[model samples]
Target chain A: MRKSTAPIISIADVKNVLGKQVVHEHLNLDIMKGEITAIVGGSGCGKTTLLRNILMLLRPKSGSIKIFDIDILHCDIKTSQKIRHSWGVLFQHGALFSALTVLENVQFPLRTFTTLPPKVQKEIALLKITMSGLPLEAAFKYPSELSGGMLKRAALARAIVMDPELLFLDEPTSGLDPQSAGAFDELLLDLKEGLGLTVVMVTHDLSSLAHVSDKVVFLGEKKVLAALPLQELLKQKHPLIQAYFSGSRGESYVKSA
Target chain B: MNNQQPAQLSFDKNTHTLHCSGSWTVSAISDFLKQPPLTTNKTNRIQIEGGGISRMDTTGAWALHQQANALKKSGKTISFSGFSEEHTALFQMVEAALPEKQPRPKSSRKPSFLYVLGKKSVDRYFSLLNGLAFLGEVIVFFGRIIMRPARLQYKSFLNVIDETGYRAIAIVGLLSFLIGIVLAYQSGQQLKTYGANIYIISLIGIAMLQEFGPLITAIIVAGRTSSAFTAQIGTMQLNEEIDALRTMGVSPVIRLVIPKILGLIISLPLLIILADICGVLGGMLVADKMLNISYYSFLLNFPNMIQLQTLLNGLIKGPFFACIIAGVGCYQGFQVVSSADSVGRKTTKSVVQSIFLIIVADALFSIILPWQSV
Candidate 1:
């Protein structure tokens, strides 16, 4: 998590455009190995778009994204598999396969990528399922059958089932009630400490941003305005950052800190 | 340092311990579990040595835990020694995260075959009753709209008619015309063999106007527009759009279903008339080409050969077939459960059920209708 450590992911001078509208220009960011870095921004600031760029769901119009020292934007599908094997992604909508049960969803990557026997695979998947705070009985349930909080937990279990060193989360706690959201933040910290994972998440929840992230990347003006710890970034004099954290709902957390 | 030394495991048989060195990480697990540690019968306790380990992931730690569990099951006590604090914590975490054995209340006895048969038959009967209940709901909604007049959805009515009506014209006409040509050619050949080629006019007219035109048009609509209705409403149901309408104080049955029923009723009879015209033209073309019947002679004999009642009987089936098609499609759409898989299944059921009902209705008309005098 230290600044001196080599970055697990680095983006240099990226430009992202969608249909003549520029989302991000000259965007540069770094995610150090073994840190929880969060991308937080206003509604249309393209936080999810930036996450997609790194995940290679959408490649930026220009610039480079490197994860585990591999230049992902220019890599072939075969080369990308190496990065894919080392990291797991949780989509905003809990994009768990609707057709598969939660246990089968967790076991999918291990069955496809690892040569471990099936019995061991089930053991590891169950471990992750319990670790993510889902009851084991819920494992056989379909995605549609799960509540919003349960859906996120199920997706988290599947994401970490492979024990990847790098994890990317897009709005991991967006739709849940406050109690569940706090529980999810605690779960995130636990996973980060337990697995020694380097996490990069896109979220707007101020409480989670203040509590969980080792570093916060504030996106604004189509670029990263500040990539600092939450307290340090909050002290900046910029009108946009000031207005963002000054809102009635988000203010108490800042004042409480 | 992510890639450290390859893992090493050694059994110190004299000390009753397993010595592990180098990186015990995820990549090494598949091979690591293959070589289980060896212990002699004299040893009552097993110790796993982890001091010399260079790296470890949760996977490596979990796999090692499984090995330790296996040793414990074999009447040997298991313990870990010389692990770095981080590695020890990770090992403990993996140990703590293991799923608890839960006692779910599962049904102990399987149902008998006779029970299953009885249940299936009851389910089928309920589904039939459900269909009639759906029809009752539609008729109630239809009556309400008729009484209120202002409650009718003109926009959706126009949209539905445009979709299942104007858009369907080309395919219906093409198929009807092709049937007409085949009917004319086959029957005219027989009439020519008997030197009664002019009778081909009566044969082609009766078949196209009295039976084939409405049946063919209905079958095509069953396959095309009916399936579309099912998929459209099924997807809406999946998206909770129907729920959204309900929360807004809108009646989903009136807003979604009734307009389709009305639109199809009005559009189908018009389409049946168009089908009849296309069929007659195709018959005339084939008659002139194959049997040497001139257009002028065909036109002169057409009214005498086929009466207006023949066309009217076929058109009468149009509204009935349309009602069945729309009713079945919308009903199946409402049956779509939460999953996307259900949408596909319901759409298939919609088409099959529509065609089946259409054919049954057609058979009734064939048997009991006063077509013989006409």
Candidate 2:
């Protein structure tokens, strides 16, 4: 995504403290509208923590997070909830509610966030399930019964059920076979085009970074090192960043890009 | 943008044309599908004019595609005009993503009621045999450990003792004291009628040592330790930690199950001993208050009335009860399927099954042993 003057999501001077350790200090980031942005970093670099902060699941020690230009840090509960409805999140390992069937899991957000009748919610959920590349029979199966790939698809269906403008995906292609991962990238790109979603994904899959992400954000040194297009990120001078994009997988990804 | 103008459809009879107008999105789908001006017969050779459409999305596209499919089913020619490039692409994408019909396998034949009954009975029988097989495996594992004492997980055994033993002391003591007081008071009332108030010591001592102490302690442990064991192992199973352990060449039975079994087996007898002492002390207190029997006289008569044989009978039942509780707890843990709800159900089942088995074992012991001989 291009760096637009008006950002759909903005983070400024973010400070995140975990016990005596500091995860992020004076971190600033922006996500443009209708762009697929991938956050990549090494272990212990707090990529997941940043995603959690943006999702409002974790509160930063100090920061200003604005979604749709509204300051979320100081916003009242009702206002914050209203803003939350404009975005959807998919967690790593699909974090699906194991107690609910695929249909119920997809319908969960609509039930909580909308006053729509059950029948309409069901219809929308079924449509989203099909869109997420799941079969009709998968609707009734429990999360426990689903394979890893199917779980991710079911979770994705739930995430997009409300047609939120911003979609947050955490390690979306992790644990999937290469074919399934490639198929998942295609699905992400398809959703971005067809639904005009501004997607923020945290992933380490270089191929996904190459194919799906319009822009890539590299994190190191307790903060974002760079936020640039995938091609530009590859040419970065930072040793860690260079090493990250120099692996065999990275070479394949660059060739594909 | 006008509300009346939105979703308005006009069919020209002369041209056989359908004019679509307004917001043809998710919100307008109900109205568009429920009230279409084009009749089923008139839809033949249908021409959809999309120029009047103010907005359309994937949902709208899907709805229109479904309508087109219906028209095709009726042998009608359909065409869309004035749809923007974006809308056209989205429509085609959604149409391509539609789920394909799959053929479900049919059951060859419905089983007769007798067959179902026989099948259920066979399943139940196999499950019983499976439980026996599990017991055999546990016994074999125990024998192997006995032959090689160095293989025991001492740290895990100690941890289980801390959890199921030391932590359980307070509740076991409290319940045993209360049971003793109830027993002493109730028996003392009837014995007073016969001027045999001193016999209250014998009643409470014999009952506590031979029956209530071990039985009550086992039941409490079943509710406490059994449920904990099931939930802990069941959650580990759900998280694939067991699979991880297996891949690392760790025997779950030796590393996980045996330690728990050893902990409960060692702790239960010690708990029963504490319970017996507390119970006897409680009876003495109640005997002094309710029966006007002095504590001095109660202590003097207690050993004479409660024989070593009587105390030994209850203590002997401890390890058996422990085995049942621990075995049932771990067995139910293994039975847990994937999901958080299964953990809760298996925990409940563990407690229920352990207590049931303990009671059954105690009953058999009582029937075979001579309690009346004391």
Candidate 3:
């Protein structure tokens, strides 16, 4: 990652959640323009909470978040919408339209964000569907008919339908089989190179972090513990990192890595 | 390696045994009901083999009773021969609690078709009367529209026109033509006996303008446009698209419901007009060909039978039917639960309820219109 490429996303001294309970506090992070970052942690470590905060889905009680050098908190509604359009999100469970065919699901963002004609819209949807490694035959089938893997691919197709600059994937490989998950990692790598996308993925899938992530952020101890390359993460003396990397849970991942 | 397959169950020339296994619960009762019936040969007797039965509950006893009932239905002897002591005790307890089946008395009188129709009419009379409740909802919806005109968006009006009006042209036209032909054939047959076959034009023209034109068009719109709106909105709700719209600072009612209501309101009258023309043309074609009536005389009589009040009545029904369609469609869509099956159920209900409301509204109009004029 080039240091000269000023951070596209910067979270500064953020404290989030309300009431007497604080979910996360005193968090500071900077994500570079064109790099893939993986947020990895155990369950209830508030990794998802942090991503939601950055996405402005949740407001911080203190401090600020800047995306593409624009303060997300202070931006007007139109500017916020514009900023959101620039980023694509792949929710857990793929969140594809159960009623719509895969092709229409992929066409959703394109239809919402652009004034492209129906034929052009269809062509763009088909291209993204193809890029996701799903066949043309699967395009007209509903999400219910798709297997878990195909649903993820279709969702990925939708996420990139508008050729978004930043892509956010929450637990992309969580429910996929080992082989399908490996294939998904390869697809993400291909997309990262092909589309020049800056990806921020939240995952418990250690195998994904080892194979695809340029940098991994381990959220622990009420803050981000370390954001480093896989090699560096492996060598770290952090007890939580060591515990996560040295067990039956980490064995398959170590082998894949 | 041994490649032989395991032995399958056999239904020989004697009693057949069905082995029941697994933990039986209320949730699994449906699956248990779907089990294939046991077959037997010369002596059609079904014997339960309960050796492998691991767990039994109230649902299991009910399933056993259902199985026995099926065997009895098939004219076979059924017995629970191999039940464990525990299973036997459970069955006895259940049998004691079961209600006695009442014998249905055979009716001596074979009711006529008209009698059956009259009975159904009586039974459905309350349902027909209860449909008046929808008018209160309609009044409330219109009251909201009038009170908060700003809530109704121009885009929604265009959307409603597109969905209800533009999408329904071909279907309404086709059905209207078919109805016209049927009306011509029936009226021609009647009028021929009196040597007045030319009167088919007046019959079809009056019917189309006053009743069939509005009613048939409304029914078709209910089935097509209302169901589409429900399914579209229901699916959006399921996919959290509606929630997303709310989060993004857009009111779902304004974005979704407004367009559908506007479209249906604008389209229904136009569609009725088109149906009216098509129905008349269909009648004219049949009158000239099948009835050997002169087209010019038929056309001359057609206008004399159709008054401006009749045309206005048909046009007036459009907005009312549109409101009914939109209200029912929006109500059903909002009622959609978070599942694909619920979406389908809501879509079906939207169409059924919309058509039912349309008919009820027509009845009310028929009763009140003469009173209003007086």
Candidate 4:
């Protein structure tokens, strides 16, 4: 696949201090349009924090961050809402509304943001639900009725129901079995290619990193250690980057690279 | 600043094509869908010219599909022209997944009166069955706890007592006290007119002890403690903590429900006693202010007119009311199957059921006990 050089998200010299601790300092990163970027880190290494910063969910102490060429830090509420409408977020636990069935959950944003007639909305929602690899019967079931993999699929359906240009997934494959996780990665790739979506995912799953990530950003020591393609990032001389893939489990990815 | 032009379709006469134009994204399609975009009335073979379309999304694709289907229904053969690769892929994906015609969502129309009555009766019958099953379990576990006291969850039992008993004192006392004051004021007016102002003691005392004291305490606790019990237990069930207890060879009833049952059984009577005292004190204050009756005179008259049996008659219902509240609350908690939605719904049902049962029990108490004090 040919990679686009156009920057979809750019963070310049960002500083994030949460309470008494410095989570990230001088963190500069760029995510290109149409690339699947993975933010990988150790536990408490602030993968979610960086994702939150770029998502405009957290205010860094200092920096300029841009998404779709618009300055996210200084934008007003209306502009922020427009930015929000253009992107989709899938939380770690598949945060579907408990009361609504999967179909209703997928249709929620469409109903809220669009003036589409309900009939067309249902058609679009059903389309997304099918594209997410869920059975049509799953649409009528509530979130609590779904198993782990089904929950993820339902959440992914809701996320992309708007046909968002950008998709954010947190630990998308964390709870699924390996086969299901691999299938999820394949689904992610299919979505990114078919929908022309730019993906930014926070995941520890090396399989996901190897399978789908077009670019990898390794976070450590309160900043981005390196941001490169998967094969290229594996060659980094930095001890932290090396240690990230030096574990008995991680070595398999490094060796495969 | 999304200043994109809304999508539009223009008809061309010579080629028999509908020229699709402008931004066809979801944000812009709102105004386009208001008026039907098809004007292929004359043409037998209509072509959609897509080169003029600047932007499109899944919503746009779906809209086009719908418009195309409409044209096809009128016996017009439709084809796409100048379509980009992305648009074609989206169109194909939407078409592949789209059901020919989706069934409309189930209507929320009201059912017939007989249907509602039958459904409600069946629902109530099941609730009664569940209540009986839950009551049987509680009795069995209560016997076990009495046989071996060490098996009881003493820490949780103390916690429940502290929560249901000590924490609830203020609201229960204040509400019943207000009721007492209102009672004294209402009856004092009639007593003063009859030149028997001091009879306000018997009027307020008998009413407070025989009816309002225990009844008010049960309702307040049902609102407060019963709802809390239901919510706490329902959330535990939702989180599978109750399941965790069961897996560990611990009975959820002995550990969770019994503590609440014992605590409320012990605390509610204590609360009723506190409410009774506060109720009388409020009545005494109102009598002093409104009827020229001193606190000393009110206290002296209390022993003469208000018999011990009147006090016992109201106080006796406390444990029974507590059983109703705790039983209904815990039963509803057990009924939560899966969702946080069920927890919320069950919590509401618990409070309603507990209060309703408490009222029924109060009515039975009045019927069984004679009106005259022994």
Candidate 5:
């Protein structure tokens, strides 16, 4: 692979917890600037941990993580918070604030990070809420009042409220219906191109990987066993890789595509 | 992990032999103390054989000495047949601090259920009762608010008014009207027996304004609004919103609990006053129609029957009961574990516990207040 323009996120020989005993040893990976990358893995594989490490939510026992060339571990709290604000994370559950209305949830990051007037904040919040394809009527309704797909859109609205440069979404479409999941994929693709975001997503949904991912990294057997495009990944000879693509797991991908 | 298993021990009371083996630590001593006494008979002699003891520390020796002393005090003889040199040294150290055992009084009576359950559980129940003892806590919580005059969060205050005060009006109004009708019906029968049916106004006016009106209204609010507060916060906790607030630098107590507490504190008295007025009006309509009493005569005696103390007493319990309801609600909410069922369980517990405490507090207040002098 042509060494992509100076990598935005670089993990050097990272070691992390595997389970009760085993650890992921000496894993090195780099994500380039302004591109969408997908980390795919089977159960017990450490893809989520790697994303967590990159997000600085988890500290590696013995390795360095640099985001935009700044060493995150050694940075002070204020500097770390500044780095965190530049990234948006969509947790697997959507993690929308249940007590807050959809508009309030979307406005949370803005209210915390900016000193903009309330009117401007509301305008910005409504814009993002609308951009996520939710109805204007949803602005006043709480998360408990929303359906599963609407909840995801509300979460996406909150995630983009800060206009984060890096977007990390963990299983964004896992629980949604097929139509909604495909719509969400298109929305991600649109954001990736329009906003020039460096997106790192961990997903079991292969259909999404094929549809939008610029690069795919397969984590298994305690390392990044393969890093290739979704199309090429299907042809790989690794038994685990072949099993994943040939089984019920890959059926959703083929059917959706 | 290899050393984590506990060594076994058994005592044959019929044979008067105590068998033991273990590396006994303080934790092991505590575990031993948790068991029932070895012998039931006060005069039974006991023998402890420590030959199988692999490792004995000071704590183990201390435990042994205590057991021996307890046995001796119960009018029984205790003999230690085998002891390692280390164990002997520890025994000597423990023996030096302990007082000489004396003959214990024999009891012919059997132990009660409470005794069998042990002091620890008794203490736990007492503590739970103490937590449910809301009169003092209610007084203190309200006293602080009224005396200190802390700068209230106007926005949250208004939010609570919207949630507790306005939302509760319909229910309180409906219930009060029904209670009035019941009161009138019950009193009308008794009053008609004496040909003094006009006195129903005095009965309803005095009773509703003095005691039942405020107490019933406060209890209803505690059941309806306070439990809702707990369930809402408990659900938020289960959903991680409380954690999110903490991570974002918002104090959940001040932002959430204080508002609800203050809102109830402000609204409950007003609700009681409203219930009292509505209840009196309902009573008047029933007495005038059902009892054939003139509305003019009922009104004439109503004012004379109800002193200023009646209204004052009702108003007094409002803030106190409000504090009780709010505090219990928030306490239960904060205690919720990360489960959906915990929300419902805690909400129900908050209402039940709050009402129970409110009544008990009222009883205590009635006994202590100078009502006779007034």
Candidate 6:
């Protein structure tokens, strides 16, 4: 892939440890603007850990993480909070505030970060809810009342309610059916073009990586093994990369791609 | 300066048209809506020109929808021009998905006196019935163990004893000792006025042996053991661990509740015995120091003061209060709903209910056992 003039996110020399066990060491990566990047790895390979580190929820033992050129690891609380407004995160479980209705969940960040009138805030929240393909009536229902698909959509609505420049999705399609996952992928692409968002997603779905990801970062053996476009990465002669792409799940999608 | 103009809504009196321009995202809309530029009620035929609008999102769509609704409400006909296909689609999508207005039921400020009384009485009646049913199930669980001693979970019973009974000894011993000291100190002062100071020994011995020692130990266990049991089982229920046990054909009542019940039954009396010793020792020490009563004199009267019946009275109440605490805690655990908050609420309810029922049971035992005649 051609290099962009500047990357939206930059990580270098990152080290992560949980007690005595090292999860990641000397990991380096850059994510460009308006591109969807997927981080894929074997089970327990710390994909989620890296995502948490970049989101500033977890601090690595040693590393520098820059988001939109701001040093995230060393920032003051006020600066970090201000920078957080430009990004959105969709957790694996939806993680909607259980006590709030769907509309209230979507409106939470808007209420916290903006001084907009309540009427306008509600209207905007409703609009985001619709854009995420949820019915208007769902706005009144609590998170527990929603089905799995509706919960993901409601979570998506909340993530994008602020029109964030960067969006992080953790296993967005893991539990979804094929049809819904396809629709979700199409929605991501549409949002990318329409709103010009930069997306970083942790996904195990090979078909999603083949179809939606501009670049795939493969983590293994306590470090990043490779970062390349799906096609090029599949073509690599590395033994681990070869074994991964030759697997039954990857074989089916690789043939189709 | 001109290029940085956020967004504006201006009307031309000649053409009856409203033109909006600049960024119309959330931040810009907030500024523009502070003092809205046009009133749609003033015109019947209005044209909205969006040619100058630069950046728009769902928030902008919502803004336009709000404007359209305001215009339509006042019987004004409006038209949009120069909006892109994407913009039009986004605006129309939000417009179509607006929540339908529903008439809310009016809530009265004060409920009628009869309503409050009826609701509360019904709630209390059902809760009482529920409690009796839970107690019956616990008794049935013990009956099963009696019939098939091999079915008893000996390992888990020991585990619960280690957690709730053994771990709780320190606090129980400390609190009962302090109670003994306070009782002797306060009563000794008043007894001296009547030249009855030596009676402080008898008073301390009888009270600690028959009431305060066991009562204090049970109360501490109620707060410690019962709350932990409730929180543990409630969290298991939340995570479907209890459901998993059921799916494997293991009855939760037999596997979970029985062990806890048996543990508390055995541990409560044993812990009470220990607490009684600590309480008697505390009173003797206080007497030796405070009232100039020597330890030898205190010990000489101690055995006479503490009759075998008095110790038996306190010990008999042990397993009963243990049953109440363990039973209430586990019952409240099963009562937990599917939420993190429900676990907390049920734990608190378990502790309060256990302590309350323990005191009530103690009162009933005292009344029925003929404490005064003895």
Measured by lDDT, the strongest candidate is 4
Give the runs in model 6 whose Cα sits over 4 Å from its true position.
A1-5, A245-247, B1-7, B12-23, B34-37, B40-55, B72-137, B146-155, B370-374
**Cα error, candidate 5, residue B361 (Å):** 7.8
DockQ of each: 0.51, 0.39, 0.03, 0.48, 0.01, 0.33
Of 2 and 4, which scores higher on lDDT?
A: 4
Of 1 and 5, the candidate ahead on TM-score is: 1
Candidate 3 has an interface RMSD (Å) of 27.2
Alpha carbon lDDT at B315, candidate 1 = 86
Clashes of each: 0, 0, 4, 0, 0, 0
Q: For each candidate, report what fraction of the true interface contacts it reproduces.
A: 0.48, 0.26, 0.03, 0.43, 0.00, 0.26
Every candidate's lDDT? 0.86, 0.84, 0.76, 0.88, 0.75, 0.85
The prediction achieving the highest TM-score against the true structure is: 1
Backbone clash pairs for candidate 6 read none
Cand 2, B chain, TM: 0.83
DockQ for candidate 5, please give it: 0.01
Q: Which tens-of-lDDT digit does each residue in A70-132 have in candidate 6?
A: 899998987788678778899998999877889999999999987898877887787778778
**Chain A structural similarity (TM-score) per candidate?**
0.96, 0.95, 0.93, 0.96, 0.93, 0.96
* lDDT of candidate 1 over A1-257, digit per residue (tens): 22347888899999999999999999999889878999988999999899889888898999999887889987788779777888888888788887788888999988998788777777787888888888877888888889888999899988887778889999998888888888888877766766687889998888888889999999999999999999998899998899999999778989875
> Per-residue lDDT tens digits of candidate 1, residues B1-374?
24567677787888988888877776666776666655558788878989988778777888777778777878998788998877887888888877767424346589999999999999999998998999898999999999997888999999989998899999999999999998898888888899898888888888888899999999999999889999999999988999999999998899999999999999988888888889988999988998889989999999887888788888889999999999999999999987878898999999999999999999998887787524
DockQ agreement of candidate 2 with the native complex: 0.39
On residues B1-374, what C-alpha lDDT tens digit does candidate 3 reach at each position?
Answer: 01212212233334366666654432233344444645544566667666655545333554566566767888887776666665666565445434343222246589999999999999788545544554454455556777888767777687678767887899999999999999998889889999987668668877887789999999988888788888988988977898999999976766676566766778899999999999888898899888987789887876676667777777788898988898788868876866687899989998999999899999998876642211
Interface RMSD of 5: 31.9
Q: For residues B196-311, could you state the per-residue lDDT of candidate 5 as single tens digits?
A: 87678768876788677887898888888778888888988977899999999876766677777888888998898888988887888888789987778877877677677777
**Order of candidate numbers by lDDT, starting with the best:** 4, 1, 6, 2, 3, 5
- Residue A208 error for model 3, in Å? 1.0
Worst 10 residues of 5 chain B by lDDT: B97-106
Q: Is candidate 2 or candidate 4 better by TM-score?
A: 4
TM-score comparison, 2 vs 5, better candidate = 2
